[model samples]
Target: MKPVYVIANNIISPLGDTTEKNFSLLRQGVSSVRLHEAGNRSPIPFYASLFPETFWQHHHTTFTKFEYLLAQSVNKVLEQASVNPAHPKTGLILSSTKGNISLLEENAITPQLKAEISFTQSAKKIAKHFGFINTPVVISHACISGLVALITAKRMLEAGLYENVVVAGADIITRFILSGFQSFQAVSDAPCKPFDANRNGINLGEAAAAIVLSVHKPLNDAPILLAGGAVSNDANHISGPSRTGQELFFAISNAMQEGAVSAADIGFVSLHGTATVYNDDMESKAITLAELQQVPVNSIKGYYGHTLGAAGLLETVISICSLQENIMIPTKGYSTPGTAQQMNVCTVLQPIEQEACLKTASGFGGCNAAIVLKKQ
Candidate 1:
């Protein structure tokens, strides 16, 4: 199979609007957590990593918050890759766990609401924006949505279905999501401290991110190739994470197998450290079982919070930026070691001229995913 290349990437999150600004703040160990005042009963006392609500109020109208943010991210990525929608061979793959439920609720409450927010509706809006004749595929696979979308794009290219594909994933924090995390006691009142001994829980945030994937494009100065990726289900529990590390073990081993690389060759592991007790414990156990001890690992949840569906793509963009700049971002709020694992979680900022990076995510519905990226 031909190598899949990440030609370009862009993101919109609470940390900052542009990719460069977010990465700059990440390198500085800045935390974006702030008090959430929705004036409604929330499970969390105060939430971290929230976007300026004014941006949404001013920039979007008439559509669901998900649609507006998704469109904005897609436009930015297209502009970066110089891909014109007028091109016939291009395709789109959109991933989101919450498919406009914010609007779904709005329509549900008001009987006059014409249509509920659906995958087809979002696809039509995005396709109309690009004037594309084909319908875009919308995928919802819990938190692994973004990386799964990337895998879909690679398959399309390998099948000779399209010369290039645009992969986008987005989800906004809403009353529904906030309540669910609170139900799990996973919403932290304080800023998230991933991999820290004192780490409490995750902070919720909203984000939209997009990337351009191609097979024949010339390798750019910092071409981050999609070496390998896999999504698997633990089927262990509906909400509780598995402590045996069975699923994550499969994901890591599969990624190495597909990339033809050893666990030791992996420069860093961008872990799915959610700052929750179960998630943190399970992820640590998995890494240890894989024998990836001493591999530097970290999570960006402290910076952007958990962006849900968009977390995978947004964090991948940050990972790519780290590779290009030769700087590894510190785990923003980590103050101490949480578990008795041998893996080297990034406690302080460091620099490395890395050639490859591994990104991982595990979410609700017993889903887990991992991907390998290489610097050109």
Candidate 2:
């Protein structure tokens, strides 16, 4: 298989827009969550950790939310990678669970807005923003969408479909999302405390992230190799998490097998610790079944809140920076352990030197994905 290298990465998250400031603050274990705007929440009293709307206004050349985020993140990653998309050999992959959903809502209510925000229109706008003559393939796989995009990009690169692949994932927190999560009782009034005994559900947030993959040698960032990854379906429940963790175990095992690594070789596990009781328990079971219970695990939700579809990309970007800097941020708000399971969840922030990290994420559609990354 052709090696898929993460040549460059960038994130626009609740903590900060640039990777540098965010990484420093993350290392310090500081959280950016604040009470949500008065009218923006449900009875659950949602919290929002967001970059200023004004901060992205200048970058958002289009009125569509997804296009704006996709363009902004893509621009930053491309600039850092020094990859000129003006070349024809580059391919773009856009990922989001709710692509243009906000716009669709508005358009449905206001026909005049319909002309601006269709899904295809949003994808086209992003492609045009990067000056790419080729249309980009858009993937919407719920919360695991970003990781799936990265996996897809790697496959395409290995197949010689493109020399350089621009993979981007972005999503905005909207009233629709707030109400939906609230309907499921998944929104927490307090800042989320992943893996904590008294932990509530997730705190929704918005973020956009972009990652560049290339077959050629990367510059100096010590780009993590996208060694291998796998996606699996639980098929156990529609909304409830699988207690057996059968699907998650399959995903972890497949990823390990593809990368030719054992569970013991994984330095750390970037868990899908969403803090929900069932989710946390299921994840713990999965880790044990994979025989990776001893691996240190942490989640970034405490810092950025949960960015839903954008979480995988945002977390992967953070993981890459942590690998480069050699520090691991704590799973903020985790005071007491919640999972009555085997794995030792790394609650407190700790610094460590490691060469590989396995990032995992699961989402609404019974979808679970795991990606193993080796330090460059």
Stretches of candidate 2 exceeding 4 Å from the true structure:
40-44, 56-61, 109-116
lDDT of 2 by residue, 87-192 (tens): 7879988888776666644545566566465556677877886788667888888788989999999899999888999988888877777788888988788888
Clashing pairs in 2: none
Clashes of each: 2, 0
For candidate 1, lDDT tens digit of each residue in 1-376? Answer: 7888888799888777778888887777777777777554364367756677688876656466788888889988888888767677788999998867766444455543434467777878888877766668887888889888887888888788888899998988777778877877777878887878888888888888998898866546667788888888889888877877779889988987887778767778899888887788888888998888778888988887888889889988988887778778878787777764656888777876458888999988889998888865
- Whole-model lDDT per candidate: 0.81, 0.81
TM-score for each candidate, following the candidate numbering = 0.94, 0.94
Count backbone clashes in candidate 2.
Answer: 0
Cα RMSD (Å) per model?
A: 1.9, 2.0
Assess candidate 1 and give its lDDT: 0.81
Q: After superposition, how far is residue 309 of candidate 2 from its true place, in Å?
A: 1.9
